[model samples]
Target: MNLTLRARRIAAIVLLGVAVTVTLLGVLLMIAAGTEDAAIEGHTGRADADVVSVTAGRTLVRFHTPDGGEHLPSVGVLYPDQLEEGQVVRVEYDTRNPDLVRVAGRGATLTILPVVTTLLAVWAVVSALVWWLRKPGPLHLRKLRPRRIAV
Candidate 1:
């Protein structure tokens, strides 16, 4: 394919934008996890959380605090990789920011694998698209005339 200079430039800009966006998303996920860990470390609360649901990649829990008020985090539990529905698991949450919670002893390190895997997957797709877009087209039929028979 013969791309004009303008088209190539546009494609380059779009690819760069996508790469930056993906990187930013991954970084934000890590940063959010770290922030939550910091919050929990500063002021922690422990409780026995009831696993209300467990799906392919997420788990939801419900629990009561010391004041006997029921609470369920809107985003569900962090580091829920091994949790099962109906199981009781100990959790550590930020008492000051009660919404921030995670399975006991699990922290931001649990986020690394999923973020890295997502980055790798996104880059694989983007690289493939870039390669396909930038690759040279096949030679024209006119450029490949059959050879004449030798005398």
Candidate 2:
């Protein structure tokens, strides 16, 4: 079960790389959520968008702004819960940028649960890998018998 020093060092390096990658992904998710929050806060408007399709992960909606232009947010509808295809649901959008839209009463808060869960899962996997990489030596019992004297 013993691991060579070089193997341990390599494991440490790989662990560090994985930690950095996971951290970066979490930060990026938070930043995107914050940006959407800011956009909503800066200028907000409401419209009943036509739901073109709905799925557990995302929803597609088509809505018209007061400026007389139809737009669909490139990222699809935000916080599109309990929605169905062909249903009309009110949404809050960044009037300055109509393409940024979220279902009414939904905001960046929804992003927290998924991101935290993902981080926890990643850490659990990395921790297991680290434990396996730094293996310990097998147990052995010492002899208890006394030695005989030489003639």
The numbered model that scores best in TM-score is: 2
True-structure lDDT of candidate 1: 0.85
> What is the TM-score of each predicted model, taking all chains together?
0.77, 0.78
lDDT of each: 0.85, 0.83
Error of 1 at 94 (Å): 0.7
lDDT (Cα, tens digit) per residue for candidate 2, span 1-151: 2357677769877996997798789979988988997898789999989999877667899999887899887679888878899999999999988888999888887888888888888888888777766665332345688889999
Clashes of each: 0, 0
CA shift of 102, model 1, Å = 0.8
lDDT of 2 at 105: 87
